[model samples]
Target: MNEPTLPTLHWTRRALLATGTAGALSLLLPPVAAAAPEEMDAAIREMFGNGTIREGRVSVKLPPIAENGNSVAIDISVESPMTEDNHVRRIGIFSPRNPIATIAEFHLGPAAGLAQVSTRVRLAGTQSLRVIAEMNDGSLWSGKASTYVTLAACVIG
Candidate 1:
């Protein structure tokens, strides 16, 4: 029996147009760079422009060493009365090594009692997680926790 040979396929204009468009579109977009320390500082300055940042009554509770960089559990507590007079208004989390310096930003009011929040965040590698809490009196408080990651979650091998 004789076997039939198939002809090689050629890409039509329709098939190639998508790839060309995609490439051209990608070139027009800005490149995504990992968050740098300078960008972190810029983000901080933008967040609390000229606001004095105090250190106290803010605590970050997370594992000193994380086995996995993905979805590390964190608990943040700010000693605030949650009263209409004095309360924590906002909490911004900064991850220096992540793709974005600001990992998360939270807005709270006096109705949010306890001024404590728990969330899981992705870590790129071993880095310090900084938290800034904005109080009702326009005072900003900061705290930091160091984490050692065994595996990276944000970076691709």
Candidate 2:
């Protein structure tokens, strides 16, 4: 009777050791740090140019303590008269601690009749969020809110 032949294994001792060492080292290393405030500013500048970001005419509402960072609810509103001459052109939400500084953005026109937005965002950790509203008059307004997260999302290593 003939017996079936088995395929030969090709992993060498050196290759196995190298792979194991690399995985071990990777597990021991810490996750990369979150984006800094300077980085956030740079991102804002890159998106909106060197325009001054004035803090007012906008409101950021969120829970002071977020139990889960996965789906934290946020409310952003800009005090503006939704007229063709004066309205919110765009709204940008930014996070300094997230893997990416820019979280979300919304665009609106005078037809919308309101400069309010409500949505959910995933946070990497406890950090402050900045909401910037761009007006039709080429002005930028900002609002800030801070929250503590018990569980973090968007973790990177």
Candidate 3:
């Protein structure tokens, strides 16, 4: 009696070569670095689109020294009348050294009554934080503050 034939497995030469090449390339390439100032600038430009970012009518509040970067409290306020004719349209929080430069963005209208936002954000390390307020009139106002973090957050493998 003839024994049952076992199923055969085949690997194409091209497939084997391609797999080897990919593995070699992965070992040779360096890991991606974290975000930088240029990334932050790109993010800002994407948001405001070359509009002059004037420094005023905005304020950012944060602890000068944060015990941990995982959950840092931040407050952003923009001076605006909060009316239909004149109001803060949006607020963007930025961290240059964070893995993601743009931390948070808030949208508001005349009905909101106040142009302020409070929240917790994760910082990769000690970095300069910037807050940009976009007005309905197509103008930009900014505020900047620095913080020292004992422990960093957003660590990447």
Lowest-scoring 10 consecutive residues by lDDT in candidate 3?
A: 3-12
Residue 116, model 2: Cα distance from true site in angstroms: 0.4
How well is each residue in 1-157 modelled by candidate 2, as lDDT tens digits? 4543532333465678899999888768753458888878887887777898898999999899998889999999999999999999999899898867898879999999988899999988999999889999889998999999988885521
Tell me the RMSD of model 1 versus the true structure. Answer: 10.6
Off by over 4 Å in 3: 1-33
Clashes of each: 0, 0, 0
| Stretches of candidate 2 exceeding 4 Å from the true structure | 1-32
lDDT of 1 by residue, 1-157 (tens): 4543533333456568888998889768643335787878778878877788888888998898988888799999999999999999999888787877888889998898799999998888888888999999989999988889898775543
Alpha-carbon lDDT, every model: 0.84, 0.86, 0.85
What's the TM-score of every candidate structure? 0.76, 0.78, 0.77
Model 2 clash pairs are none
Tens-digit per-residue lDDT, 59-105, candidate 3: 99989998888999998889998999999998998878886778888
Give the local distance difference test score of model 2: 0.86
lDDT score of model 3? 0.85
